[model samples]
Target: MSSANLDQLHRSTLGVYESLLDQFNPGLQRLVALGKTYIQAFQALSSTSEEYFHALGRMGEQALHTLSSRSLGDVIIQIAESQRRLTNELDGMFRWFHSEVLREMENNVKLDKDFIAGSRRRYEMEVHNHASALDRQQRRGHQDVVEYTHFLRDSQKDALKEEERRYRFLAEKHCNLSLTIAQLMNKMGGALHQRAEEWGDCVNETRASRPRTPSRMEQMGMREEERAQQWTKREEPSLGRVPSRGPSPVLMRSRSGSLGDGLGGGRLMRAIVSCAPSPNPTLLDFSMGDAITVLVPEPRNGWLYGKGQNSPRQGWFPASYVEPLDQAPRPPLPRGTNPFATVKLKPTVTNDRSGPRAPGRII
Candidate 1:
């Protein structure tokens, strides 16, 4: 082919490359813009969720202020704490997506586009310069000048071929970001799912720890029935039933030396024998396995008062130190030396005895 014909063919091919670049440029730009829009929407959703959790935390703070003493307020506080953690993790994930994934996609796309476009432009410039030099050399009408221009044109053609090869390679590599971006998205999505699941599990654990309210009439009725049975059993435990937690207020007012049969303390019972030495004066001191009398079967603030079996060592002691005896204790033998030798005289002083108590530390 003639040089003129070759130049015309090269120019025509350059025009085709320009058309393809112009068409593909918009598509690549549109893809980037669309991706940005998608990421922005995702970011907005995350921001909205973070704000929602913050609102919940504020609401929980209000609940705590209004109902500090209530159990419901405590549960609300726990929920708020959990939601705050979720929001923090969500924010971190979004930051990584924005800084790492989105930035990488944008940079790669721009770099690839620039490389392809630059190579095409460079090749076109070299071709144009070569053709101009040939026309100038031919116009000089010098054989030597024409020969030198041909040499220069051959070098330029070699350079153009390399540029063309690079341009084709770059264009072929265009938009290969799909698999890379998809892989990054998959990794980020998995991390997001894991964080969300952890938050859900934490919320579930908080709910599980909360106390359930009585929701049924049957449950209320059952509670009342259990209470009645407890009182009846404490009054007469020989029937073998559940015991009352404490004495009733009305029955606790008995001024008599001995309480009424309704309370479990009226009878004399054998001592539990095991007693620890106490620092307080009101607390009874006794050796291990020593005999004593008990005034109460159950604990009242963890204390019970009674007189010693053979000695005048009547005072208060921990309820844990004694239990009700199945059999009545053997009365001390009426003697001349002992002050509380008579069994009948013992209840007179010990039964009305409600004054002595160990401090809060004793319990």
Candidate 2:
């Protein structure tokens, strides 16, 4: 199944073949030597005379006759037949050795080729699967980037609309202030006219009662002198009560000025104060990619905190038991404030009487 397993099988098979060769080698060597001796003997016999051959046979017969064992002739014939069959089998074994070894080697070669082919096929299939997966991931990543960019653009447009609304509110407040001042001025003018008419009536009543002791000119002079002094006090517009216009765009913009330092001072969208151990506290940790989360003291299965904050509460924690989770890459920050920072918390309500069931106050 595996390349390593296949290799071990091949090694084992080869070891067996080597061991068999070792065992058969000595027998093969002995057979080769015996055959060589027999060939030499035959060559000498071919050159020998007919008388010598007859004498050799008589000598063999005399030797056999001298043996006292019964059936010596039969025994000699049996021994000769046995030698012939042994020699023939030995020769057959030698001849087939070449064919057998060749066939075995061919089978081993075929096995090796098959193992290599299977391994190559498996490797190729794995590579193809990996490539397809990578392509899909790339496509998904591209889509996410496009969606994020669109979201940022929409946020920017919303911010611009909010700024426009603020300016419009300031203009309306200014107009209302102007109308209130006009109304106050009209009321003051009517009061002044009524006072003047009352003075004229008093002068006519005095003239009708008696010949005017002080002339009209004298009365007019006194009135003019008094009026001049009073006018000085009322010279400046009394529009302080008539509300000055609300802060103009210029003044509002000044109040919300840019940061003096290089680092901007806009509200943080998210401020995660990670109390993780520093590599070298004396030096700055420049690893911006690192992120951290606050680890609430609890079990892994979210059982300690209950379902919500309704349970008896504990304060927020820092990054004590937490590890950083890798975040996807993000773009650079744009210049703007987060409106959420402007939200105010509701005032806390407290009961006068102290009891076990007293409500929690949101201080």
- Writing each residue's lDDT as its tens digit, candidate 1 over 205-300 gives 656876456568757665656665564346432422213233444433335645644333343444545567666666677764455565444545
| RMSD in angstroms between candidate 2 and the native structure over all alpha carbons | 61.2
RMSD per model, one decimal: 20.9, 61.2
What lDDT does the true structure give each of the candidates? Answer: 0.56, 0.39
Question: Candidate 2, after superposition: displacement of residue 196 in Å?
Answer: 99
Candidate 1 pairs with clashing backbones: none
Give the 10-residue window scoring lowest on summed lDDT in candidate 2. Answer: 302-311
Model 1 CA lDDT for position 331: 43
Candidate 2 regions with alpha-carbon error over 4 angstroms: 1-62, 65-70, 93-98, 114-122, 125-131, 134-363
> How many backbone overlaps does candidate 1 show?
0
In angstroms, the error of model 2 at 312 is: 99
lDDT per residue as tens, model 2, 1-363: 343543454344344334333433333345445645654565454335333544544554554665442234334433344334434443444334334433333444445344534544553464355445546767888322333334334434543453354345435544654564465447554654675566556556645765535687777666666665464346423222211222122322222474212123211112222223344322112123333222222222211111111222112222111223443343332223232334599999876555565368542
